[model samples]
Target chain A: MSPEKVQGGLEPSETVAIVGASLAGGACITRLRELGFTGRIQAIDCDPFAPYDRPPLSKRFLAQNTEIETPRWWSPDCEVIRARAVAFDAQRRALRLRDTSGAERNISADAVVIATGAQPRRLPIEPDGVFALRTAGDALALRHAVDAGAKHVAVIGAGVLGTEIASSLRQQDLQVSMVDAASLPLVRLLGRGMGARAIDWMKEWNVDLHLGVRIESIRCDHGVCAVTLGSGVAIESDLIISAVGARPAVDWLINSGLAIRDGVLCDASGSALSMGHNVVPRVYVAGDVASVECPNGSFARDESWTGAKQQGVKVAETMYYGAQQTVQPEPPYFWTEQFGRRVQILGRVSENGAVSCVKSVPDRNGGLFKVAESGAHVAWIAINAPSLFAQVKAGLLP
Target chain B: MKVALDAKRCQGHARCAAFAPETFVFDDEGFSRVREGFENVKPELQEKVRRACTNCPEGAITISG
Candidate 1:
């Protein structure tokens, strides 16, 4: 909380620069304006398009044949610059940016928000007709491929995104086979019982689940990909979608002296943490690019849309209030739509936790609750039962 | 202040309940709702209610007098 540790507070006339211009950056800028901050704001992004939500990329946006509209949140007075930040000068609080034309520029600001987000993790052998969805363009390209008669799809990784894509494709009458190295998809997040339930749902949706197998090689010929599993079984498909998760887009922060681990390491208050445990002044991080360490000593990189937006507001507050204002940390929240059902999860559920069905009916399939070994309610998962989820969430609150 | 919730957009994050437990309550399925008789947040808890609305990631909560 020292001013020298995390830099001085913001002044009314000082300029604040934000990188990424994705959900987190958009939230930060919009919240700042909502709070009536008159300081100069510079929002930067490499993409030509304005800020947009990414959740629909795999669901509605990909399934529909309509135009994708970018969500507008910035004020008329705010400056939106289309450029990629190449480097950061911590001492001077300036960033070196490269425009689309390859022209370079330097912008100095009193505070900087790194919301660069993340990019999809690719496999070692990327053959033709392989796709990964992270941005709007990626989704559009995959949709176009599907529309172009790509019949059978082999989705690698059965996590949230992969399962979601598989489910969506099934709804569109496209044959989908989902492969995952884990014994059960989402086991790490939902634990054994709940994760097994997800498997049952996927089977019910007719998605071929190839679990506990490693992909040996991917060979593509004439717009068709033949994926050979470790068991010497080959699965052929018209296209392959790799939803193997994402890593923080932190290439620009390298060599800038910031402690780069899985993502930009930050304290709970959203200030960037250096290698020696000191806060890097004026540098705040949010969204997928930020791995925040809580007081409990564990670090979490919440890649959900909700986490990104919440962190964005917190980081903006830290920039304006100089870390003096204690941020009330919210529970981790995430939701996914697939198999014509909405799966909503709130709070953290450990792998060994005991899960029980809090509510069960023909309409509501997944109202399961997990409690820690200490009998503390840890997490709740609901399928199309948002109100039930909310009830469980409220009871867990202090 | 009058507190409103865009129930459809709420993903049952429960952040609103955490910030203002007295003003907000959870529906049977876990989405947020104004307490049984607290549709208009009490004057003493209005600030906390506002914080709850502000922290909602879905932007589902709103407050206006």
Candidate 2:
């Protein structure tokens, strides 16, 4: 859903207040109108510019400083609130806002969609040249450093985000060293062998790899920076990137008095599941701020673009169709183009290094590994080959 | 008796995944994705499943033997 679509959902909505004016919020608004929702639609975004894509902040946006070529990922024109959300009143169905002037306005509505997204996790030690890759503002800050051709960047995590950042930095000729506490670059999810392959790729690119180590503290002085490891090794760096992880953007809801565990907990239907299943009729949460409950009653906090968009659509469906229609969890998939390899994984991957078989595509120098016991096909990961990925994904659907 | 997750809680935390990965692979979110031979699982494998339950960070698994 884009900005143009959201403006259309306005006619049907008696009064719709989307607390988040970003991607998910923008998409929800567009989708609602697209589905024939006609009512008052209000989108509140903390950032001045209307919603844009964030994934690029780590890759293309960093590699190339060009604005979106065409699809803005938003409608042509939507009322972007450019205001920060301060609080929420579930009973009154109003959202508190502090505009650029610092004036407070309690905006009320029939449907309140909370889409306040997560911010980057900052390190406690605070190295002078340290940075994060979350918001566009953060990207701009890092972009200057990259454009300035700052050499020798130390990426603090081996996760996808960190790896991508490292790759982008490397493309700019900055010597990058990716250090992680995990045994492998992607140890928490992909097993050690997969991690080894990641290391192999990084090594091929000459990005220094420091696996199975902990950074005790980071210190910076003037233009130089250094990080001390638990092993008593000092790594000198020009820039330090803390790409550890992210927590929920649940501060406003925390004082709002709604049920929150990690994030605003919602049931399978996207409704605020107060006290676990006695659904509140009007309130809803979507995106990084919401904890979606699977059909089995266990909740998981997701901070991915796909999860946010999928849940945003689901929330709209639940509102229009009603809660009885259950939406099963879709297959979780994410991909990254990094270090001269496009790495993609579908289905679940074991961290303990389990491999049923690795089928190689001799032509492309890639292989597809079948995760055993995963039914007909659990997941298929491909490196540098997308055709094989498609074949496996299409065949995996039960 | 041994317990298994309902495929939802099994977000590959893999705490319980160490048991018999050949028997318990995961869904994209890292949960117990496949339903395998809980009945025919070897004794040691069953015990591994029990340990997975203990290590699960989200407390998404439980086992009895």
Candidate 3:
């Protein structure tokens, strides 16, 4: 395994600055050390607290106040900088950081990794006191709101995060109402069959359904919040949470000389691409901020938790070992815990593929497999059946 | 070397089982556990187990000497 470094790759003594102490950034730092890279890692964390796991923020963290401390691996051989990366100088491999006190400074490194992840998208008519879950502080604020006698909650957007937030709030005995423009929740990702099933689950959970409707306006007046729909009907709640979706946190890299469509475009190895010029010197993008070029010659930004973690590892391997490893990209996978059931999706589901229920139990514990005409399993969605999902994901299902 | 899977922490991301299928077993709900006999770790399987431990999002796997 002793191989020369790729052209322009970082040396063991070089320092790497990771902007955004996100899952991808965290994973990259850990994997680099595991790969025997002795480079100094600067972890730039924007959060007030140290880097902590975010998945629980919408799950157990809000529902039960479980404390998720920073992982033990982040402390050793790494400098934790509590600052936000304001700008990136790709040409000079430098970053402009703005600390909590509004102080700004420029620090340079041999290699730069952008793992800023994404921020929750707000509604056009978002009023004051609207809640959006992205960080630990945001989760705490929501929990505080609930603790402060928040009974009825209106959640906008029925996407994964929104749905999970709704489920979590419901677990607290809060009356939750969900509003989305799509006719069905997760219709784009799960398609009609599985999406319909999702609707059924939400309905069964007693979440006030406001699907297939446009939110005209949101107003919080006199201690009551009203979400007005396009049909002139309004659903009143004590609080409103805007979870329409999220946009990649690539605003800082706008002038970084890297190509940006939806996100910072990168090659399969996570190397940031610069149009009409040689690739930006050792500047890589991973996690939600990276729009990675896939084997099929298409660019995709995988915003899921698993995708971010895998990309973190892959980018670290490329940065340290010089991209020689021809590892196959792991299939895209994400799971949502809603209504106390774990719904997981693995692999790509072709738009026109046939989706059939391979095995289903009355308790909503089963697998839904998607396949093209070639008879190969293209995608699988398992509800409350993790073991079976793992088997089918490992190609055990013939 | 020995490894332990914290049942409380495992939210069933299943990256452990994916990385080291022989060493990690999945429960019905998709959470992972270090296989019974393999918790002690074999010499050849140590690397895979390490990878699994690192890849786990939940950080449920613990490796100790």
Candidate 4:
């Protein structure tokens, strides 16, 4: 690659400011350098610690928080600001931040990257005992609750995150009950046939799964937490996990005025869309904050760990390195582990219709599964049969 | 003919694509995609491909007419 893009002699060419030094932002910075973005590369985070992993936070870390205190950090040379990006000025190509010390700093950049990951969405009732798992602090807090003899843990939401959290709670020897609004667990991701199989696996683990139901509120009853479902049913528990889903962390970008859609609206190249009227220069976005529209006319707002990492790296390469490669929205891919069953899906599932399992072979607590033609297979989901998913992944002709 | 996944109408059913991997791919959020060789999915594979589309729960995948 070309020599790292440099700005000045003593000072670099142009300062690069990355908001949210977590997964996407950090990946971009490192990749920018790899793609020869040698100018002063900077990354900012509100947390005192540097950037780390997320999958583990929900899986291994939750089970053994005592062993892994926080997600691992980056190399010593990579720049990190233990601060929060508070605002973006697309006009001036600058960013406003409040560091860990409570001091605000204004940093200007030739370009900006918004990778302000997501936060655990909470319910309004102020559930006295329920919590959501997203950040390191959240994981640590949940660990404390589990160790403190919290019995009858009720995890709300039956998606991957909620399932793993409940399974971990059960591993801690706490009775776990999983609640979701879907007819079967993972109905949205794995389809009905595979979903039933997943429920069967959870059953083996003895999880009290309340499928097709949602918990309306979490309140304490006689010193223990009572989770109330919409059906006027209360499930007694010492812990409750609220994991519906995560929204874009765009509170800071409210007035940034760069065309915010479900996530940040981005071009095929991951460049931020502009209404620049000459006052603002072009800005680009990737990761969770970016929703990329492929040249093929398809679009995706990907938020998985793999999606963010690869997209971040690609954005850096295309913009800085002269690859000039346009990003295509690939099919969705994510995996979840619950009660010894590894469920992975390669494609989308429609909400408006039916799901018929194409082929079935007995495998895990469930078996290998492929979610049929939802809308995209380049993005498909597979569980315990990546070998079969591999056939589809290669675009292999039948 | 172009390929498209009508995401709004999708439900995860792996029918149209599974039998004919050469013709379709059912991925993320119940979205189906037209495979490469867009020019030619062998006549033998057409039945499997069409069957997948017919069995699709949401009828989301539609190849250009």
Off by over 4 Å in 1: A1-7, A65-67, A70-77, A396-398, B1-65
Q: Give TM-scores for every candidate, taking all chains together and pairing residue i with residue i.
A: 0.87, 0.78, 0.94, 0.75
Which runs in model 4 stand beyond 4 Å of their true positions? A1-12, A65-76, A220-223, A275-282, A294-299, A321-323, A327-331, A351-363, A374-381, A386-397, B1-65
Candidate 2, residues A1-398: lDDT per residue as tens digits?
22233221223537777877666676676566555676667788787554666776788678767563222234434456778888887777878889899998888887778788787777677655678877778888888887776788889989888999988888877898888888778765455557777787788889988888978889877658887899998888877888997777878775665788888888866787665456676688888888888768788876666567667767766665444234555576656778877666776676654555466766654666655433444455676555456445445422
Off by over 4 Å in 3: A72-75, A350-353, A364-368, A371-376, B27-31
In order of DockQ, best first, we have: 3, 1, 4, 2
Query: Pick by TM-score: which candidate is best?
Result: 3
What lDDT does model 3 reach? Answer: 0.82
lDDT: which is higher, 2 or 3? 3
Give Cα distance to truth, residue B20, candidate 1, Å.
Answer: 7.9
All candidates: DockQ? 0.40, 0.02, 0.55, 0.02
Best model per lDDT: 3
For candidate 3, what is the TM-score?
0.94
Query: Which 10 successive residues of model 3 chain A have the least lDDT summed?
Result: A365-374
**C-alpha lDDT of residue A311 in model 2:** 71
Better of 1 and 4 by lDDT: 1
State the iRMSD of every prediction, in order shown: 3.8, 14.5, 2.5, 14.9
- Worst 10-residue lDDT window for candidate 1 chain A reads A1-10
Candidate No. with top DockQ: 3
lDDT of model 3 at position A296? 96
